[model samples]
Target: MTTAPHAETFHSDGTPDASGRRVGVLLSHGFTGSPASIVPWGRYLAEQGYAVAVPRLPGHGTTWQDMTTTRYDDYYAEIEREFDALRARTDVVVVGGLSMGGCLVLQLAERRADQVAGVVLVNPAVNSTNKQLLLLPVMKHLVKAFPGIGSDIKKEGVVESAYDKTPLKPLASMVAAWKQVRAGLGEVTAPVLLFRSAEDHVVDPSSARIILDGIASADVTERVLAESYHVATLDNDAPQIFAESAEFVARVTSQVAAS
Candidate 1:
């Protein structure tokens, strides 16, 4: 009667059923994205004997309308719920995300404390006032007036969704959420492993340095994805991301075990 964890198509990205494994990594995807985006990474982890949960937020993986129907709090709340589930099923957690998802994971670390063993951020969104996104409200209203590039996310090797059309209201809500998350960096206590692409066209690269300085974690390490772009998850350097992230998780899990 029991099913394998992650067996469901819609992964909650929270905790897993505690049948055997004790370690878990919860993955949160970026804004305007879905569990499908992060599923590859989670599947890789799952093969390594780790329970991986990739949570799809309210609006994601559905339609632009769904995204508009969601709020920033709604998005963060899903992450919170999933992280708590992971906490219940595992002894330690290494929480991570890409872009906006990365910001949410950090918020979880700050808010949840040691319950989160470590943090991993891949091109995380830190600040909210960047020029391209300053006119988000307008973009939402007139997305068709100017259907922007889907994803210029150039990694050395991977190609992600390059959708031309965009829904505006969702982005506005995300911008508001990003502002809230940026204001909350001080609360993160878990150690961090940050990966930033040198040529990320979407998020500002400089923000990583600011995060490295601002977070409260006692230890922080960074990796530069020189061959990647904004959506590293689907970039050519994705393998590197998978490999490096795996090592990071192993290292942190070991640290907690020793202590």
Candidate 2:
């Protein structure tokens, strides 16, 4: 199967800081999706001189069938590797992601609260209100996959480079990770900026509500994307996500510097 060109990993060699410590941002894509979904946002951060890493999660950027072989631990391992690399090189690190990517970053924030500078999430998916997901444990044993939940963009004619099918086993693993992360939300103390699309088909508003209500971060900001859907990073309100994320990194890092 031929993958879309945008699905490839993106990297930007932003200028190093004068103080010999870099400022970096790590952007992760959603489940069954590649970096293509968030490349524009990463590019925006790169242009502002923040070293950006958008790694293709394991089992993604290839094919849906390939994703079936991987589990959520493998996906989080990729993000953790990227996070460690950035933490070593940068003085302050800001973590951001799209959907499952957002959940992964929250896990990272919970584990590395002392190192993470800030957090940015666009339509983050932590929990689903859909009752059908409750049957995943049993259904995954009989069914191998389900219809894809990708490309939920409100903008016309735009397509997200994501898997056409959702692998039930991997999805079950993802849901388990979501539960683990959600339970630890109170441990995340970094400044957070969240962008929730008003009409998302894939992730329910409860995901955002749970995050906002659970996280202990006192500096939490939520902006509703009026013109987008689940993939707001690539939808009509993408510019808002890009601009606000850049501003968020700058603001939080400066605050750290001052403190």
Candidate 3:
């Protein structure tokens, strides 16, 4: 695995939200996305008097060249380390992620149940095959050779760049990560707040259904972002994401009091 140089940094315009024993929230962006995707959500939560961190994964925010050298363990390890940091800063840490980042958070909640107070997943890619959609692992290999999807497939509430070039190797890595997380789904017992886009074409919608059906968390609540697509964090549904997530954090924080 290629080890990239680590430059640690934290900059938030809002004051600490964990004052007076409040909860902290950690936001993670999807694969191929930098903290930029979760910046809006982090800022919104921070402004509401909550400490938030949107960590930059190793090799990310640098270049596709750097990402090409990293492995799935490298990605998952960085998130686990960051989640620990967030936990140290506050009494309760509510974790959330977008897309593959969502899968990372779910994996964390399963194993570190005591540390994570709650979860919010936006357009999570839990299972590769959702919506009766067949994403042949073989297709990724094929796309590696011929990486053009022809035209930009337009969806509501967002504009997709349409990664015409599929790096089959990267596809294989992400799938591996998903498989590990999927196996650990039963372990993530924290109450989860799930969001799905009715129009998302990237990740399978069935991914959400599997979580809803099996997770031990009794307080799971799901909302459909009817107005948006896969990248709901950037689309019109962003406001709804902010509002609902803020509420979910508050709900979990109250649990601390009850206990």
List where candidate 2 sits over 4 angstroms from the true fold.
1-4, 17-21
lDDT of 1 by residue, 1-259 (tens): 2222322223333333333337889998877666655778887777666767788777666545545666778888999998888777777789899888898888788788868888989889877446777887766676632353335466444444433445566667766676666677888877788989988777886679768877888888898887777888777678888888888887888788878
- For model 1 the local lDDT of residue 53 reads 78
Q: In candidate 1, where is summed lDDT lowest over 10 consecutive residues?
A: 1-10
**What lDDT is reached at residue 122 by model 1?**
89
Structural similarity to truth (TM-score) of each candidate: 0.84, 0.96, 0.83
State the local distance difference test value for candidate 2. 0.91
In the range 1-259, model 3's lDDT, one tens digit per residue, is 4322322333353344333675678888766556766777888888887878888876565555555566667767888988787777777888999887888888889889877889999988778654222454666545542342211223443433333343455656777667677777888788899999888767777789877876788789999888777778877788999998998898888787579
Clashing pairs in 2: none
The per-residue C-alpha lDDT of model 3 at residue 208 equals: 94
What's the lDDT for residue 49 in model 1? Answer: 64
Off by over 4 Å in 3: 1-19, 130-166
Off by over 4 Å in 1: 1-21, 136-150, 155-158
lDDT head-to-head 2 vs 3, winner: 2
RMSD after CA superposition, every candidate: 4.9, 1.4, 4.4
